[model samples]
Target: MNTKVSRVYPRSLTFGDTTVELATMTAADAPALAEFVKTLPVHDRLFVRRDVSHPKVLDAWIGALAQGHVTSLVARDGATMVGCTAIVVDPLSWSSHVGELRVLVAPAWRGRGLGRALIQENFALALGLHLSKLTVQMTVDQRAAIAVFEELGFRAEAVLRDHVKDHDGQAHDLALLSHDVAEVQSRLRMFGVDDALQH
Candidate 1:
């Protein structure tokens, strides 16, 4: 589980008036990331895959990033964290061609297209890792997230009825969306992002 620190990370992308710096997650960022997650609204926190408010869970995520089990990227506006995204590739040989994407954006940053930018970054990383497909699971009511993925060629592949329960014990259906890497590449080419793919 030796992790290689990526030198090509910490790149910058601009969204309207904001300039976001994206970087690979590392052990040193665990505390900061945890703090950032704490600022999320309670409803948003309920959907996060890990209990980021808990120190142990946050530590575990840091360890996973350090071990290369997850490829994570964080977006920062100046010194403040605004968003984070990751792709987890299965170690099992049978599922090696597929990866799962996760994203969390600060409430204030939601409508500014940062989420879409993060997804684009994930796609590039997935391509570089040679993954053939990517999947994302979200509650069916997340229309904004669904729309963003759909715009990028991801389609709903499955829906699990009442798959998740919120803090109030209310169940919610989960929708799983998937994208074929080849199709994503084609879409990017259509958008004149072929230059990005070449890197």
Candidate 2:
């Protein structure tokens, strides 16, 4: 796989008066990432597969980054992490060409373009990595997040009833959304859009 794409790192994006820098996530970012996750509301954290606020989980994520099992990008306003994303893949699995996309943005930063930009960055990264498919799941109530993904071409794949429980032990329905990356790329190439990816 090429593994090289147009780098969005050190890129500056503005949302209203707020400006954030986008860069690849690194092991050194664990502390800031933990603080970012800790500030998320309980409802928002309920959908996360793991308790990212915990040190061990964050440590494992950092380890994944080192192992190339995960590719992440962090959007920062100075030293504060305002948003982040992860593309997780297990190369040994049968679905190795499929990546799971996880995106999180601070509550205050919601509705801005930050989240969409992070998703776009990850989409390009997925293409560069030669991933054939991408999937994302969230609680059914996250309508806004789901809409954002949908706008980017992800479609509903499945729904699991009461699949995830909150800290209070209340179960919530989960919705899985997926994008056919290979198909999209093929269509884009047919339409001459793939020329941009050649560089």
TM-score of each candidate?
A: 0.87, 0.93
Task: List the candidate 1 regions with Cα displacement exceeding 4 Å.
Answer: 1-7, 186-195
Native-structure RMSD, model 1 = 3.0
Candidate 1, residues 44-126, lDDT tens digits: the string is 65445665677887887787886676889999999888999878765756877787888899888888888998998887887
Clashes of 2: 0
Clash counts for the predictions, in order? 0, 0
Q: Native-vs-model 2 lDDT?
A: 0.86
Q: Write the per-residue lDDT of candidate 2 for residues 1-64, one digit (tens) a residue.
A: 3334455467789888878998888988988998899779988876668878778989999999
Q: Model 2: how far is 52 from its true place, Å?
A: 1.0
Q: Quick one: best lDDT, which candidate?
A: 2
Which stretches in model 2 have alpha-carbon errors above 4 Å? 1-8, 195-199
The C-alpha RMSD of each candidate to the native structure, in angstroms, is 3.0, 1.8
